[model samples]
Target chain A: MSSVVIVGAGLGGLRAAEALRANGFTGTITVVGDEVHLPYNRPPLSKEALAGGVDVPGLEFRRKASIEDVDWRLGSAAVSSDLAERTVTLADGTTLAFDGLVVASGIRPRRLPIPGPQEGRHVLRTAADAHAVRDRLRPGTHVLIMGAGFIGCETAATARALGAEVAIVAIDEQPMVRPLGAELGAGMRRRHEEHGVRFHLGHSIDSFVGDDHVQVAVLSDGTELPADVVIEAVGSVANVEWLAGNDLDLSDGLLTDSAMQVATSSAPVVAVGDIARHPNALFGSVARRIEHWNMPTETGRRAGATLAALLAGDEPDRGPFCAMPSFWSDQYHHKLQSFGMPGIADRIELVEGSVDGPCIVEYHDASGLVGVVGVDRTQELAPYRKQLAARAG
Target chain B: MTVKVFVDMDKCQHYGQCCFEASDVFELDEDGKLQYVAEADESRRDDIESAADVCPMQAISVE
Candidate 1:
């Protein structure tokens, strides 16, 4: 194989390129991304960057020396692909052929189709979005967040820290209910409330009312929230449009085997990062697209090895990919960290400390311990992470 | 061969993610602050590089 093209210039793309080189694949690599900037740390965009300010250069990922020669085609997106011809057409009308393809297009923030003026509504994803939202956040401003997810809750905390009034309206009973569970999630909501953030739980924003900018957020319960800005942190949509017409499972995301090889692809196509719904042996045979920050590094390593092997006309490792998914969230001074899929657990027990302060929560399914969350106990999470990462034969 | 490893004290968030990759080279102190060896055998380069890569703050540097 002489060439490889990686779609999406995020952390995943950078790692994939680095891995390709590390695996002794001396092919020319080109990364195509819609965003003009290279891969940057995005988790800070909601916390420090949101409250302090957005700095694209400061947030950019540090590339290893191995991938320095990789071509970066920024500012244009991959419009479509022809799997049979091994060609990808970019938005700039350039068609590029590759011996191996890395489907790392990642995801975009999903916007709700609510009746509202688009003007003051925003979603936190890119550097530009963070900067734009930060510019509007100040004292006397009211930010009505429309989702109770981590992003929404973090934005509430950041907005509140900026001296802006923050109100969260969501359909869930508590903030971060999906991952932290109702009990612990409620604890999180209380922490946010203690910091001057208001929660209108079990409510949805009916619409945003104003002539130009959002002036009021009408909740389903008929409570109208005065809003200077509305942040919709509902979820994300996989950027799989470019892979359309290809005979691949683009249902939720690009379905891949445990080896990161695209399922039933016409060529040596491998999907990685957030876009690949691959199974983990540690979690069972169920393929899940974990949106955690570490998934890109884990999947990219495996995908790069798989693609490099396939390009070399060699068989790839059939070993089960059992990466322990993890993510962290900072709201105010409290830091919440998790290892594995706590959302999949049916039972949870507070193993140490109280919910109001430093604590370690263990999540379990009928099988056994499936996840662990550490609240301000970062040092103690390593053992639990290793436990979740242990693969069962 | 020996490699020099450095962690920017100012930029480090002490998330302890690097400990998982190169526990021998990087570890959090009792106060949950990051402490790492400045120089190590080159055989540990792979582990040190992985530790640097996984750092969320991008505060680790190896030479």
Candidate 2:
């Protein structure tokens, strides 16, 4: 009899447990999570959940019949781990030994170290964060967003919908330049601006000006913006501190092989989701951790299969792990859907229509077509997805 | 094992991700809305399961 411990009870952990059962692993599976709530959808936390209200129970992931018996140790975060001893110590000092380990600890919002009044500060990551932000997003409230990524842009749209005066301050030239290229990103910025959202591009928050609550936001460019509620959607840091002394690659996230295995054979440990920097054959041999909505199921399925084979004393097939990363963003009526890594593209050409309206964009590097993003062009994307996969494969 | 598939339309975003996984079971109509067959063959269980799993909104449920 063997037991497996999976850290993080989000989509990644839940899928890993289901994958283990689907692979016929009848061992005890325990999922330890920092959050009290079970695995729920986080995307809505910035959009619908943030706008209307945070529905913690309604946002939960549907439990597959196979993983119904998994021991869900929620609310207790993993404080530390002894990989050599095969034991995990929780925050409450409870130590549990396991034969298998799955690292799905995920990430947290990265906050800038600017001196500020913390009372009106917020980050849209967890449900609680969404709830807290939602309370402050009343009509006519001045919402100052600190990032222009998907989360920041989405939060801006949500705040605008709630009648909040929205303003985005970031160092990027466009809203999503890193991922959607300058043309599309600028197009998105135009759309946001049309909706009354102000942009403070190429600026950083120098410090906050307030006694207790955030009354104003002072920018690096010496511009002062009145901010009633400050939402920091800058980025995220991988939560890999628990496995600090394990001698694993924690530079950005935990590094793993294509099979999601943390090592060759020292232990049966695999990492998944946002924490697992696993290599994808679709994007060369670069092991990058993607924070898209689909990576959990993709990596968890692969990780579970690898762990199950190891536990059965059989060598798992060492095939190159390949998964087409897909993500969709809904701000206002425009639905931005994408397949493949658009960020790595050197050339971005608009194939159909204009950027402000419905359009399709192709992202290509020197190698050829790398990704495709379609706005309100859902039906036409299937062919592009297949073509990209075949070309990359 | 004939799987009974039920999709909560209220929750469906019509992202058409499920159509990629199980094209025969879930399809996006001309209006780009989701339309699905409630009943599917057991042989297509893996693909249907993948369809339900890949759904961004998690609106599909197969039994």
Candidate 3:
């Protein structure tokens, strides 16, 4: 029987495995990952989970009642992979050979690199990290957040909801300015400040102080604020170190074609999730690598099918996996939904709804109508999904 | 037979919805990262395709 080996047991990896099975492949399939826990939902990590309202199991996409049959090599890290030999070598010195190889290894959180930074310093990428931050969220505790991105905002909302005094230190003039652009980003900043989160904008972090209690956060502007707890939601880096010596075209990530096939070497390999940087025909030939939740899950499934076809001696004929990039965050009592791709929004207009009630913000690139950001209004963003898809076609 | 599959790990958040849809190909490791068979038999294409259709990032690209 043929064997298929996958690295990284993330949403993309798991979905790719399931796709192989559903495609009727009766092969020896093996999955390898580095985490010690079963795959759980990450979106809730900053929302309900941090609020102490949901347990880990409740966030699991696969319930215990509906487990799948596969060689689950859990807690094993994939140290290196040979694209030529089609084998994945685990950290334990075991190697799994495969007829096909999929690199679904996701990203790792980027932490603050500074002196005296140790435990108690946190990043909210996983469930455990969220729990740690939640434990520190006692009423009246002072919380200092680094970065004013989506994660930082969500963390601030969670902390405020738990009655913690929250402060955000961002390098950007406005929160989400890079992603949502300046105008809409300013609106998001106002929303947070209105809810009582202190903001120190356009400043860089100097260092985190204290040996045990994390008492001070020093900024480049020479401002030191007393902080009871500090959470770093700065950003993330692609986990592509394994391909350092390999011939793969590793720009910011694994360079791939629209079909998600790695555009390097004669060996057949594909990359997905945050580790992939591929071109999208929809956005002025822009290459994108999105770290959101849903994108990888869908990509993994599609890649699995494409791989199945290649193995069957059939020509892979799948089109570019293009879906309007969308993400939502549950912060405080607000449900913020961002639809389409806002990476290149040159202008944002308040077309419908209101910031006082349900609101929608449409972003137009030079080509018109590229993205939309909605507040307390998911339905308003639904219609644009089809429109975006049509634009891609 | 050899097949090529692509996964954008940056887009994948380790959620395990794909495992339920195509167990033969996808599984969750103990660490909770999603793992999958890199290749599959030709007959299982439809199911794997469906799994990809459901991915949130459109992270999967097949050739």
Please report the candidate that would top DockQ against the real structure.
2
- Tell me the lDDT of model 1 at A152: 95
- Judged by lDDT against the true structure, how good is candidate 1? 0.90
Q: Order the candidate numbers by TM-score, best to worst.
A: 2, 1, 3
In order, candidate lDDTs are 0.90, 0.91, 0.72
DockQ of each: 0.74, 0.80, 0.09
Residues A1-393, candidate 2, lDDT per residue (tens digit)?
A: 989999999999988888888887889999999999999999999988888789899998888888878899999999999888899999988998999999999999998889978789899899989988999999999999999999999999999999999999999999988989999999999999999999999998999989899999999988999999999999999999899888888998999998899973456899999999989888888889999999999999999988888888888767988789999999997899999999999999999999988999999999888899998888789888998888645
Ranked by lDDT, the better of candidates 1 and 2 is 2
lDDT by residue (tens digit), candidate 1, A80-155:
9998899999999999999899999999998888897889999999998999999999998998998999999989
Over the stretch A50-152, how does candidate 3's per-residue lDDT look in tens digits? 8875476655554121126677898878888777777777889998888877788888888768665565678888776887788888899989999998989
What CAPRI-style quality would you assign to candidate 3? incorrect
Measured with DockQ on alpha carbons, how good is candidate 1? Answer: 0.74
Worst 10 residues of 3 chain A by lDDT: A58-67
Candidate 2: residue pairs that collide: none
